[model samples]
Target: MNKRFIKGTMAALVSMLATNAFAATEVTVYTAFESDILAKYKNAFEKTNPDIEINWVRDSTGIMTAKLLAEKNNPQAEVVWGLAGSSMALLKEEGILKTYSPKGLDELRSELNDPQSTQAWYGNDAFFNAICFNEIVAQQQNLPKPTSWEDLTKPVYKGHIAMPNPASSGTGYMQVSAWLQSMGDNQGWAYMKDLHSNIAHYTHSGSKPCVQAGMGEVAIGISMASRGAKLKTQGAPLDVITPAGIGWESEAVGIVKVSDAAKRVVDWSISKEANELYVEMYPVVGHKDVEASVANFPNVQQKMAKMDFARMGNERADVLKTWSDKFDGKSEAK
Candidate 1:
């Protein structure tokens, strides 16, 4: 072969290898999923698309939402994997999310998808407020198991309650919002006032309250149902309880307007595999066809009230402010 031709062939080989090396896509995902489930979700997605790598930033729903909103102009996240729909709605309202409906949108519950023509988000799963009672502590204290939301306000439970604060936690905010809608605004605030007196502390993360209760830091925690059930299965002396009425919100996913890779990820987010993964964690998945077990909160479907999506979105800030003014600085800070 001619020396120049041989050299050109070698160069072509190197260029080809470099192009292949740079072909893999990296999607930056912001999420509010628990620390334990993060790895599993990442692994599952990577397994199916080995060429695509996920860079995840995980935190509580409220914190994640705040972080995303702060970075709106020079947005950092490629996609949001698991966040509150209410938070997503707020982002959509701000026009930060890219308008793209995934392929599986028709399969999801109508209430879970974005209302606008350019759908900004899609729901994955839901979580609701529940009670976590430390059976050992309750037995020792000779405490009776409370079956209603109002039962936690009893004087006997003073300094033995923990719950998330609405200002900083989506789960907390949803529960409060649900109560106000269900019991009427005036009565809900009155009920919360009575309940606040018994609370030991208001946690930063919604599920932290239940974990604290399970660990015996507090006798009871008002938190989401799944977290309490998982803690109990881990041998925490806790029993997960869903009261007669509770507020619920769906975990959702959306594409940030900043990246093409994010748009691709969002396009894939509502596929059958993602739906299956969601059902594994949440019984009432975004898709009605999917079924899974939720051992702790029985009949979870029946317990979820008719939530007004628009109403929640509109009143979120005001409701949170009202809650803060009424209850903030009242609990002992940890």
Candidate 2:
């Protein structure tokens, strides 16, 4: 009855579909954020920003850093989100990252922001190292659960501990960096040598060590406290132990010199909504008003060693090389 009208409507529909597809922005983000939470944040952000899409490129922190560095001239990522703050600082020093402050940057803790506002990278949350002890395994082997960094070096723990390699894992570098900062260089290097004897293997991913311990693959995992807590909550016979002073680092976000559409994601990165999501895994977040709601979250404020991101960034290459020379023998396949 109305063949011409029907044809016109079909054409209009196709044209509208094409317009919307072209209009929507696809932002590429390279991140070392945990695999489990990637879907959560992506879904949440897209829900709020219907026209902006997130395409995540995920890897361990150190690997992601190297990838970004390798792609310096022809950047593939529009934004670098959830990489280590020190790594972001390093990128800023390399002139790889652009300077664009997000809308809510002032609401975050000033210390978590780049000391120079021109760098334009900011932390979202802090994660600290802890001992993930498989109590069952420890009891089976008659080994004591370690409560301090020094305790892992005892003879009983030899070849029963798993560690993250600082060369490939952000958590690993943070732990190594913190030790050096807190214990003095001479003592820190000496301490690592002692602990090196006990390590069963070093993992590329920070969370793998704890998962290995939870599975009874290793008795102890030197990893993030939140990881230990997550494993225990899943009914693993694991004890999440936080020592008196542990190394810690913040996960940060920065915009690459790409499309202006990337700024929307960076803006949402520091928002209260995003900070709330961060607290789902981390107890410490950059936003002062956002309280952590994680069940049985460790008290890490007093335990964190004083960190200088600038120093950590400057010394990263040297520290990683030395650590690799000393401990890379135990590392698992990349």
Best by lDDT: 2
Residue 73 error for model 2, in Å?
2.9
TM-score of each: 0.80, 0.81
Deviating ranges (above 4 Å) for candidate 1: 1-14, 17-22, 25-28, 34-43, 46-60, 74-78, 115-118, 135-142, 154-156, 215-217, 258-264, 309-317
Q: What digit string (tens of lDDT, one per residue) describes model 1 on residues 167-257?
A: 7777888889888888889998999999988888888788999999888888899997888888887889888878766889888898885
Which residue pairs clash within candidate 1?
A: none
Instruction: Indicate the residue-level lDDT of 320 in model 1.
Output: 84
Q: Following a full C-alpha superposition, what root-mean-square deviation does model 1 have from the true structure? A: 3.7
Query: By summed lDDT, which 10 consecutive residues of candidate 1 come out lowest?
Result: 293-302
Off by over 4 Å in 2: 1-22, 117-119, 134-146, 155-160, 200-205, 215-219, 258-260, 330-334
RMSD per model, one decimal: 3.7, 3.9
Q: Which TM-score value belongs to model 1?
A: 0.80
